[model samples]
Target: MKDFPSCFGESGVQVADFSSSTSRTAQNLVSCVYQCRLRGRSRLITVSWSKNLMGQGFSVGIDDNTNQCLCKVDIKPWLFSKKKGSKSLEADSSKIDIIWDLSSAKFGSGPEPLEGFYLGIVFERRMILLLGDMRKEAFKKTSATPVPSDPIFIAKREHIFGKKIFSTKVQFCDNGQLHDLVIECDTSAVSDPCLMIRVDSQTVMQVKRLRWKFRGNNTILVDGLAVEVFWDVHNWLFGTSLGNAVFMFKTNPSAEKLWVSQPLSDPHMLPWSWSQRFQDSQSQCLGFSLILYAWKNE
Candidate 1:
């Protein structure tokens, strides 16, 4: 399969581009992309949360509708003396600001904070993207007018470390049921290595002779919604050490449309039918994409 661009690139999977020396799988990070509007113009904001030996930190990047980056700001962990502050920038003669407070934030195993934190992106004194539970605190701290932009959660990319079985919790829908996801693959057997995916302790998808079918897509029903699952495990089956596999779960209308659009000649180059979904998600939308970079822990 033709290797697609690293989905986790925006999520801090590879820090080299971010001018960091950390290895790909060394740091725990999560990248979430949101579709928001500012001054009647739609834009995409990428919020990345990272945690390493130094502690937790985050970065905010704003991109236009055409995917052109308007501005990017990195808040280093050491620079968080107040742990809550605002950074203002000029974008197209307009003021773009990023405000955050993580001093009293509570976190779980992941880099993202669970509570007592607020990260707000304000444009022209209007809050475009707001995260965390402290909405009132975020508005009060930033002095941003309460304009409801209603940012849509479009995509999420995360790195998961494991050996044979990788597990994580994800919610397919907003405020929906959170399901347990388990991916088990024993690649020790070069001849016959089976791959299985379980959701909520139930097998949702399985591939028996995974060697030949290392890269493909499947459709599984979750919460009465069809989820298109795309997997690329070519590195796991054949590659040097430190190789990682990529999996994407997207909620779409019809799985047949996703499969039929692909050319049958080359199955490896799985043309992800995301152009339409991406457009829909930005416009009249409520689509969620979860991308996991599974790293084998040796």
Candidate 2:
């Protein structure tokens, strides 16, 4: 099989491990979550980018506060004949339009474009979510008014592959500087297994006795904001299958509110409880989370 590079190539790797067969062909995906108001009610938007042997593609989904999907649209991979187009959909009796132009877009090694393109989501001719650098072209093509309130980026989930060193880029807050996130761990070193996490080459967190503390949470400050880090590497340490490790970085002071029903004082308790359901909002304010699933290359 041939190896193809994605447009944004921060962190993506493939291994030849067939121990479980499932981990041998893990899907490459990047999903970004945004919080915004729709018809006076809070809603969430998920934009997912994906790539496979066929080509690069993307999907846009809208969900209500109740966690119900209101609408979704998928743009087939670069079809050559339709690199730029628009689609209109209806949700809750309201009109929604999605437009994009990737003809000249440049990509790194990831499925996401690096520049030269724009993806716009308009509601009633009003721009709701506009991404990419081609802002002027997007407005002219969609004939949309400037956004009244900017959407808040709340979360991002991405899959990465590597051997012992995995790296990616992240921004803790809107308009914040993008920092390099690097995770180094050698699971094969059973005698002295350790884990280290660094941001912008600066070591922010480290773990010893990997076998004992495979699941835990810690806090680190970034850009003057407190970020709680949760990790689960139990699979890498002891699982029979070649599994992936999960890591989440949350940047919300009110994040503790999500665990109000749980035992906060218990040192052995995990805030997320190894579950992927972390959508609790007690306050009107939105929070941000970055989840990375790191898979080791055989």
Candidate 3:
């Protein structure tokens, strides 16, 4: 109840509802957006990684200031012979090359690879966005020069599943230390469910009488920085048994807009408009946002 803002000016503010996000809450997916300078112009590249019965797949898209998808590519490289490959596409009349090698990539429970992989985006013979631990292999394969304009990771959205406690590790800021974030709640066990959030094994925020205050926003200090957190669990308490809850962590300095109802596609990705809002949130340079669609396994 403390440190939670209940107003924007004198009028009360409520979270916006995302068209849909429930179906994909249990899927293994991670979407990240990066901002980089291309030829002195700001650009954003979105990469989405997914894991399902068919195998692992990824998609890359380039968007300019106008929110237009200049070029995009989707690759399912899990087959034996196609584990590594390169794709060339033109965006804004500029040739762009995307390369990847997941032959030996290691993955955890989630869709994102843990290590042993290289996904590179090259432009004008220079590396713009390079991910994974295989830097040497990426540069060698791409034949691109290293420049000072590496991409800035601004936002990440992940879907996590659990029985009652959902947990993940994340970095709140660019080059910031990684911390463990955990959310715990048991709707069926109690008449009035409570919400608890912990960071690095320490309790940072908790809400009692969750049935009455099922939706709200609070601010917590992390690493000497203010982090705004918002949660909505109406579905968890009143919806079907498989309903999912929403949680978001924002690091915007002046972020008065707390995300509540609006949220996420593929059978496993967010919906069109929902995903659009997620990506659009990044274009605003709103520091970093981490949205977790926590689904209960019960």
Candidate 4:
């Protein structure tokens, strides 16, 4: 009997051990999750959206040397299903009558090549999203941009309903220059609903109205400005909004304080009339953290 780490959090489940008999080399592990423990012990649960593989399911394993507990189970086989034609076939059905396609074809290829898994671990009041595989080196090179260690705050806006982020914008004063950074999520959308930004340890001027246009037709407009820079940001908020939200913070360099403004507004001029139908609002501030997830282009 192995002494496993005590499970924490409201989930009431602890992950004891996980492993796959299939070679981890040829196949890329897409995602893994530890579901509610079985019989009060951690049960390994995993999801692999791979096309090439078979016997795709969760597996459980224990470390023999450590006397740790382990379990393995196959959820579903990765076998393709074929549909028979309408013709009434005799006892000997031709194999050609059935179509052979990857089991994942039903869902369609999501991104491409099915890259390795990216794990976001939040432990002991800290958050870190680890990017795995060959892409790790590339991420390091691109993220080398000098980001402030003690940043006043960080915001990560993800599209809850949509396929991906419509746009990402960052506003901050760097070396006396007020800079605005924007990136389009998908060019075809022409506008984005979600927006996020972070400010370093510097106070911002407070005003009634602030506006800016980024890559997409998306525009941000904000009212009211307040500032406070402490506490992890994640615990303070929740919900799915496609607009800007104001976060207040005080700068270490200035006693007067400043506002870190994010304008969340509708993209009125977007080609799709449905775009106007989308609502823009802000959720409560959950908390704050400096760590965020970034992907490397292949």
Candidate RMSDs in Å, in order, are 4.8, 7.5, 8.0, 22.9
**Model 2, runs deviating above 4 Å:** 1-26, 78-81, 257-282
Put down candidate 4 lDDT per residue, 92-126, tens digits, no spaces: 12110111112222221221122332222121212
- TM-score for each prediction? 0.83, 0.84, 0.84, 0.21
Model 3, global lDDT: 0.73
RMSD value for candidate 4: 22.9
lDDT of 3 at 163: 78
lDDT computed for candidate 4: 0.22
Error of 2 at 286 (Å): 2.5
User: lDDT tens digits, residues 2-33, model 1?
Assistant: 22222223542234221122454446878788
| Residue 215 accuracy (lDDT) in model 2 | 79
Model 2, total clashes: 8
TM-score of 2: 0.84
TM-score of 1: 0.83
Provide the lowest-lDDT 10-residue window in model 2: 1-10
Instruction: Quantify all predictions' global Cα lDDT against the true fold.
Output: 0.73, 0.72, 0.73, 0.22
